[model samples]
Target: MASRQTRLRVISLYKELHRLGRDYPDPSYNFHGKLRGLFEKNKDLKDEAEIEKAIKLGEYIRNETLALYSLRKYRHLKRMYPAVSPTDPFP
Candidate 1:
């Protein structure tokens, strides 16, 4: 059986990812469903090394999701305000 700490951390990570999936960029993709499915697929892992590896992968995914959100915001901002040129006078 995995240690209590490990179990708690896994649950917390799952919750975090689930929350992030709420605003996932692609409306066609079911992020929350996919997240749950993946977690279910790995729930039987008994080896610590394997579990750790999976957690690391999950964290990497979380980071990538945040990056995607940031890029989306950047695109929106860029669209709203075109870059000013040197020749343009400040308003």
Candidate 2:
């Protein structure tokens, strides 16, 4: 099970990503690479508290990058899952 802070950070990241994804729609390696890097760096954090903090920051960065990258896609996404919307961009 994940820590409370980690879970909270994860949720925050999702929101941030969804918002960003909604503003900019694009499918580029650079965009994905940066998002992936954020996750990877967060995973590298050793201390639990530090990891949680990094996770939160990672989520923010990832969401912003994704949102910027997929703004158009995000707009169309609202039509699919109006409630959840871009929260699950893959869907």
* Predicted model with the maximum TM-score: 1
The top-ranked prediction according to lDDT is 1
**What is the model-wide C-alpha lDDT for candidate 1?**
0.93
lDDT of 2 at 87: 75
Native-to-model Cα distance after best TM-score fit, residue 19 in candidate 2, in Å = 5.2
Q: Tell me how far the alpha carbon of residue 42 in candidate 2 is from the true structure, in angstroms, after superposition.
A: 2.1
TM-score of 1: 0.93
Each prediction's TM-score versus the true structure: 0.93, 0.39
Give me the runs in candidate 1 sitting further than 4 Å from their true place.
Answer: none
Deviation from native of the Cα of residue 44 in model 2, angstroms: 3.9
Cα lDDT tens digits, model 2, 14-39, are: 55664554444445545445655666
Candidate 2 wrong stretches, greater than 4 Å: 1-5, 11-15, 25-29, 59-91
For candidate 1, lDDT tens digit of each residue in 1-91?
7889999999999999998999998878999888999999999999999999999999999999999999999999999998888888893
